[model samples]
Target: MKKNDWFLAAGIVIAAAVILLLQIFGSVQNGLTVTVSVDGSLYGTYSLSEDRQVEINDTNRIVIENGSVVMEWADCPDQLCVNHRSISRDGESIICLPNRVVVSIEGTDGKNEENSLDGIAG
Candidate 1:
């Protein structure tokens, strides 16, 4: 309604746009490695730059190609992990709760300390 109110609205919009752009570009970094874990223990870590398929404990299989990783197969009845999308950005992951398998993307130093909070409870 007022000139100051209009300026305040424009400033808020600009700030929101900048924050959104930062979030998009910041999370777009290509991960350097794919880390696999089973039952809360370290299974293996593979380079994301290399394309290959990995079998985990005969219960799950994953494919890494073109800088992205995807769960190719899983014995779990729900098939949630198998149906999940590929992950290529740092801290992205595909988790198989039935098999207790976690496939995550890590940065160049093979660590994702920043976005480690996978979930939160109210």
Candidate 2:
């Protein structure tokens, strides 16, 4: 390849790397709680300061430890949520589409929480 082409390619790679880094570092914040929803309805919220395991509708189990929450078990066929990484930052979530369950990290200080529904109606 030409020198100018190589430089352009390097510039693109650098820009991509910078954007990735910003996304990784920018979204991280100390979340205060973990919220769980089932089938688009509000299930419950648990404190992150204390570690524990939560069972949602007997279909999914989540373990909160070390200020991070992870899906420890799920009865769904794919088990994608069970293998998801632990989330401690606000806005991070593990969604189980098959089970219609969503587990998300949230902060109560009024910054991380935005436009969230206060209740769900059938």
Candidate 3:
């Protein structure tokens, strides 16, 4: 291989490493709130800093603790939402399709609010 080729390869590897590191570190901010929606309606927003339990219209149950939120129970048959892992990142979510319940994290940058009502619009 030529000297220029080796330099080009090294530059590409460095660029890729920088991109990967940014991605890993950029999304580390803790979520500020948990927004719950049911049946295309805004149900409630709870702060992750406080530990609490939320009942979503008697259809889904949510638990927030230690800066994370999880679906503790759901009346839906599939129970996919209930099985989802707790999320504390800005864009993470646990959605129950059968019951139309969605639990998601909201970040300070405020991107989620713009798309939060998408389900209702369509």
Candidate achieving the largest lDDT: 1
User: What are the candidates' C-alpha RMSDs?
Assistant: 6.4, 6.6, 7.8
Q: Model 3, which residues run further than 4 Å from truth?
A: 1-31, 108-122
What's the best-to-worst order under TM-score?
2, 1, 3
lDDT of 2 by residue, 28-107 (tens): 35547889999899999999878899999889999999999999999999999988988887667899999999998877
lDDT of each: 0.81, 0.80, 0.79
Off by over 4 Å in 2: 1-28, 115-122
Candidate 3 residue lDDT tens string, 35-113: 8988889899998889999998889899999998999999999989888988887657899999988898876555544
TM-score of each predicted structure versus truth? 0.70, 0.71, 0.67
Candidate structures ordered by lDDT, highest first: 1, 2, 3
